[model samples]
Target: MVTFQFIPFQEIENLGSAKRVNKLLNIVKENKIVLMEGRLKKQEEADLIEITMEEISPKFKGIELSVVYPNKSKQDFGQKVKGTFANLLLGDRQGMTIIGPASVVKRIEQNPNKIELFTKEAKTPPAKRYRKKK
Candidate 1:
């Protein structure tokens, strides 16, 4: 029912990220996902730093991509939750992907049936606080 797009880091870099923030801003789309890899580069040696989408918003506003954190929606998405990340890593997960909550994303994948989204929904929201008894 929901429609969204997923973009990669390479495509974003090509768009002329006047400042890294500019590139991050351009990719912010509703229910969309961003696949990225970030490592700190230094003149001599580089260290990999795992950065979350929330850290990319130099301005720290939602910047179109909403952030969802666990058990908290009291503050803005960008402020509290950090960018919503999928629990199951997709593709080269050591890298990262940005996306909406699973329900919207479930619709984006191929041959989506109620079975997929419903299955996750049935198990998650209620379990946010306590693990459901087996």
Candidate 2:
């Protein structure tokens, strides 16, 4: 089973960038993938990278951080008009940010409509061969 920790952006919205970075780091050290609603602030992202680099070691692998950006599509004229107004008000639809150890997280891919997570296998079972007798 896949397990992850979740942090709502609103939880850290009021905190300073440094505090946000620290909170994220502490949770990520527990070695579970984190799914955060809304992206991290620019300053917080930068600070997180800097701090992670400083603390990196041979055994302690670094984190894989990624954002799944909102996608806007144009199809119908009426829908387009509505979307434009929504964009003006909301800026952009908030997307998810994932952070976790590179060892476990593996890779993250962002597509127009979805975020794909690829993780390392915890254990692999040996392959079995089946034979059909004629």
Candidate 3:
């Protein structure tokens, strides 16, 4: 069965960058998809990918990550200014981040209107046939 875990920004707001990345990675390693409240800083995102690569193994195939944020191109000047101020004061809590294990999540696609997350189907072992012996 597939599992999803929601992580609020407040939950990791106080954590160091490494801790935050590790926390998310740990969840992903468990084969659960993580829906995070905010996007990580650019550097932190890189670090997460780097760490994931290093941890790739037979049991841990790595992660699929994506971030979705508002598009500012169509926003008015005043709206942009307000958004900047809000980000400055409240941290970068404007977007959503998704992290899932590669073994489960096949891919993640994002567009201005929506996000599509495709997951890999579970592979069940074949049943064994038995015959009576004389």
Candidate 4:
């Protein structure tokens, strides 16, 4: 069975750019998809891409990153108001960021409403056959 690794925004928020990238790189190297709770800063994201690209070699696959934007519609009054205040304090809205191996992530659909990663079906061993005595 395939499993995903989830990293909360708060966990990496205090970390420096280099440390953050290193942490992310380590996770992706394990062939696991990372579902990050919040978006990465522009500079942090760029640095990550640059460092990751340089690390890519014949044996290593680079990462694919995608952002999941938040929906403003359909929220109740309390939620909408809270979101607005948070945005004002934070300067912008935060979204989910997906990071994974390029080979595996290439098959994922990056839609804001629905993000999907398509993994290969598990294989089963064939049954053994025996011939009756002739």
Q: Which residue ranges in model 3 land beyond 4 Å of their true spot? A: 124-134
Candidate 3 lDDT by residue in tens digits, 1-134: 89999999999989999999999999999889999998899999999989999999999998999998878897899999998998898776778899999999999998888899999988988998899898
Local distance difference test, per candidate? 0.33, 0.77, 0.92, 0.78
**Model 1 CA deviation exceeding 4 Å by range:** 14-20, 29-31, 37-94, 99-134
- Residue pairs with backbone atoms closer than 3 Å in model 1 (clashes): 69-81
The RMSD of every model to the true structure, in order and in angstroms, is: 18.9, 6.7, 2.9, 4.2
List TM-scores for all candidates, in order. Answer: 0.25, 0.72, 0.88, 0.72
- Runs in model 2 deviating more than 4 A are 72-93, 123-134
Query: Residue 16 of model 3: what lDDT?
Result: 96
Task: Decide which is better by lDDT, 1 or 2.
Answer: 2
Report the Cα lDDT for residue 49, model 2. 93
Poorly placed runs, candidate 4 (over 4 Å): 71-82, 89-93, 120-134
Put down candidate 4 lDDT per residue, 3-121, tens digits, no spaces: 57999877887888899888988898887888888777888889989999898987667887877766778678898998888878763237788888775566678754687776555
Top candidate on lDDT is 3
Stronger candidate by lDDT (3 vs 4)? 3
Q: Ten residues in a row with the worst lDDT in model 3?
A: 86-95
Model 1 is weakest, by summed lDDT over 10 consecutive residues, at: 39-48
lDDT of 1 by residue, 1-134 (tens): 34335454455443332344434434433333333443112310111112234344434333222221233345486644342443233212223333333323333232212122221233334435667899
The 10 consecutive residues of candidate 2 with the worst lDDT sum are 86-95
